[model samples]
Target: MTELSAKYGPVFSFKCGQFDVVVINQWKFIKEALANEHLLGRPKETTIPGVIEHASLIEMSGESWKQQRRVALTVLRDVGLGKSEMEDSIRDQIKSFTEVIKSSEGKPITVADKLFLSVSNNISKLVFGQTSAYDDPASLLMAKMMPEAGKMKFFNVQQFMPIIANLVIKLNLFNMTEIISHIRKFESHILDEVNIHKTKNTDDNSIKDYIDGFLHEISKRQNEKDSTFHVNTLQRNAALFYFAGSDTITTTLQWMMFYLVKYPEYQNKIREEIKQTIGLNRQPENVDRKQMPFTMAFIYETLRHSSLVPLNILRRATEDTKVGDFSIPKDSLVTFNFWSVHRDPNLWDNPELFKPERFLNEDKSKAIKPPYLIPFSGGRRVCPGESFAYLQLFLYLVSFLQQFEISAEPGKDIHLESVQNFVTRKKELPNLIFKSVD
Candidate 1:
């Protein structure tokens, strides 16, 4: 798509099966298209089989999307998403993660599983009001399931041609049978959790987690006409929260570790910055980010260079719309090619280089996050967990660097190449050695 954009223009339209997809590569047009109300609708046919049936927050449109988003934001805020309480929970998980690292002393360790468990536990706590043990079967199952689910090709094919894809799904072709079964298992798990939450007697004031808050909303809106609150929606929303919340953060953190080992000098710089700003005696706090400019710059650079989510989720035009003179007919699929923006030479200098100083200011004292760097995306459909993810990334990186020096295993090479997925791009795992700083 970026190659096509180079020859065709920044904004180009192409046919994918029955859908006309408009790919916006430049930031100016992406910003415009995202803000347009007509382009905010998600395509109904693009939804995968056994994945909420177009009813969850990611697929829903208009009034239903608004109501669910509002309720979710409210619930997230009330449940300590951006608060100190959430930070403490994340820190607790980081401590467990460090312990897992320590246990692998003098041996090469693959951080994916342990890291996934730590990140998943945090999301589990937010949704279920409790964290799971690292070795818990359910937690481990999800940790294994998410990356496997990402590897399925069915998700990619469905985006362009849903009718044939649905037929293929019905026929159980393309190894989708296993993926669908796993998705069903996930749905069943969420349903069980929802039922358990329902069994508990709780009121609005007693709302403890996301399920509790959502249930309270459902009860209050039951009297209203055509209310979107119900068991199915709740189940789907919880699944979305759990899957998306954990997978993206875990992938980003893995990339962070990959870069730490690939560029040991920058790792030393970040460690030194951490030592000067936040000594090893105390855990890193969210507020400490303000004082550590280079660390923050490094984080921002990782987000941009990794480009984990190269393209925003496919959005549909509800009506005819114009994005920078390109006419998008009704129901046309529109996507923002963030990969191009992040790597565009016009927008960034030496776009291929992994330079954290690009995000630093003239004096190198403060981090200057340019508007073009939209890893969490932008506009109304921007990631709601942006703040939460940032907090987790900052705290995890700081805490881990404070305790250990990460490097590739002896005779092993670290590769920055990523395996592309339907939604996210995951790094190729490499066994790492974490030498204790103590």
Candidate 2:
């Protein structure tokens, strides 16, 4: 994108199928575009299957989007999304996670599998009011299929050529059929959970988790006309919550380990902060973030360095709009190139260098995240899970480092080059060896 931006300027146009997509590269333009209400719609529905209007949060727009997002936000807060309960849940999962690592006995291991169970369980508590054993069939299937979910973006070839894309999906080319089958199975599992929550019928009493709250709403609005809350909607949104909640956090943790292993000095600094602030007797909590600026700085630097979701999902222009000097037609597809914004030389002193101090203030007593350092794209459409994602990243990171040190296995080198898909992840991760801190 940097190369393309250099050649075609910041605002450039490209065609994907029957759609006209305008890519905004610079922070100034990208921010302006995202904030404009006229540019808030998602791309054409045929471009993304299972994302039809009201089908899921990402696919819906206008009233349906607003109602669903509001309900989700309120229920998440009620369930202690950013509070002590959530922290306790994550910390408990962290303990289980560490045991899995201990079972490895410092032997070489691909850590993502063990880590996903921990992360997913944290989300499961919020969504289903329960957690799953790492070896559970459903849990294992989710772990196996979650990474492939990223390919949905890669398979969005329908955006450029509907006929060919339809044929590709129909013919099972590129495992499209198999992928959809897995997605359906995943959705079925979510529906089963939703059904269980429905049977409990906690509506007349108190809402328990996200699914419980959703079911309560579905029961209340079952007869209402044009109601966005329903069984199918609940199922799809539940699946979305699982997908968004688990995959991103899991990938960020994976990157956190990769960087920590590559630069042991930063890991030492983080450990020192944890020792000075929380010490070893107690588990790390979300509240400790303020006392450990350096640790937060490291996490922030990783967010910027990785730019996990490189392009912040596709958006569509609701009406004809003018961004800078360029004119964007109504219904035009739009996307922000976060990778460019994070790497722009004009935005940072040395954009390519991995220096956490860059996020710290002059005296290093406070962490300063620049407005332009937008790992989560800004505006009304900004990630609703921003706070939750932050809490998870900090607590999980501190908890892991407090107990052990992560390093590449013997004879294996850590690779930093990322595979660009739905989420930016290391092309290949060496089996990490965990050494107990004590």
Candidate 3:
């Protein structure tokens, strides 16, 4: 990375090949830009298809962004983050996931769709009052489009015309109708959850979820002279939280299982460790993870090698900032390029290997791992549902490995290629033989 930056940082203004791109890792400048005024929800702009949309806050300058971002972070904290109830629900959801798969009686399965159903359901339970039932029309709609959305940047009317871009976009008649239909459907789902939050039972701590807390916020600022906090923003952020958090983590877990089946040696090591640590019939808990070090390392290696969320977060510079020798212009896009850094040969011994041992330390033949892995990402936009994701991921993988071992089908391709773009997973569904270990 140092070598690449030395040769390319200045040349970035030219060779990076995009108007808003800032190449390489610049943690301080990037973090500053997130909290800065230059792009914190101000003068909006247009983005063509095939890119990640710069955050809504990336347009505001100075004081406005500082104020808005503070509100956003505060709201996230107020909601149930890293709390016990959410993790408990996630653990339950994975158990539900097992029941669903077990009904199929060890048949080869497309576990991604079902696992996403459970994870997304758990997220919805936390964010709103209810979860999406499997086979719901709305669930099917989003599932179809999520991969499409990630493959290419669909139109973003809000970024272009904050006020009436919907009206402006009407000039295009045909495609505009489809876009509007999807947007309304999306908004309607969120609005329904907003309403549920409004009516939550305040009498019980058993309420234990985001909606109850948000309803409290609605009341908190109801009498305040002018409050930036609104039911609308809370609703939007809640929907965004569930969608963003569930997709990437579940996708990575599904792919990890795919690869585990592909490489039986790795799967056996993980299975052996789970058996030795917890034996059979015991559920995996957060504390038990320390006992399953090899299994934990396997998941870590999967996160790195899969590089599912391939791009570092999109940060638009708020003020003129210096990172390395180059000057990053205000309001320009500042990308962290985690893909590059994660794969950097300088930092890793064999940058492309699937070895999980790199993360374990013991005798001379052993390895040591770092704690600052940013798979859930970092900074303000780092996922608030990260704790839930950890529970879902750990329990789902550990449970699946403990009960039934998966293997690629005979005469089928074991080297299943992955789908890629902003984030990714296996293109081919991992239909595998799940022989019961019990």
Residue by residue across 215-247, what tens digits does model 1's lDDT show?
889889989898889888888888889988999
- The TM-score, computed over Cα atoms with residue i paired to residue i, of candidate 3 is 0.81
Tens-digit lDDT track of model 2 for 1-438: 668889999999887777788889999998788779988788657334432233588777777888899999899889878888778778889888888888887788898877887898887888888999989898888888876766556426655555576677777776777777787787778878877776677444578899888877877788989988987888878878887888899999999999999899999999998899999668887778899999999999999999998887888888899899999999888888999999999988899888999989889999988888888888988988888899989988888888888888787777789888768988776788888888
Please identify model 3 stretches exceeding 4 Å from their true place.
Answer: 1-11, 14-18, 25-80, 154-179, 199-208, 222-226, 364-368, 379-381
Sort by TM-score, best first: what order?
1, 2, 3
Which model is ahead, 1 or 3, in terms of lDDT? 1
Instruction: Tell me how candidate 2 scores on lDDT.
Output: 0.83
User: What is the C-alpha local distance difference test score of candidate 1?
Assistant: 0.84
Sorting all predicted structures by lDDT, with the top scorer first, yields: 1, 2, 3
Give the higher-TM-score candidate: 1 or 2: 1
TM-score of each: 0.96, 0.96, 0.81
Mind sharing the TM-score for model 2? 0.96
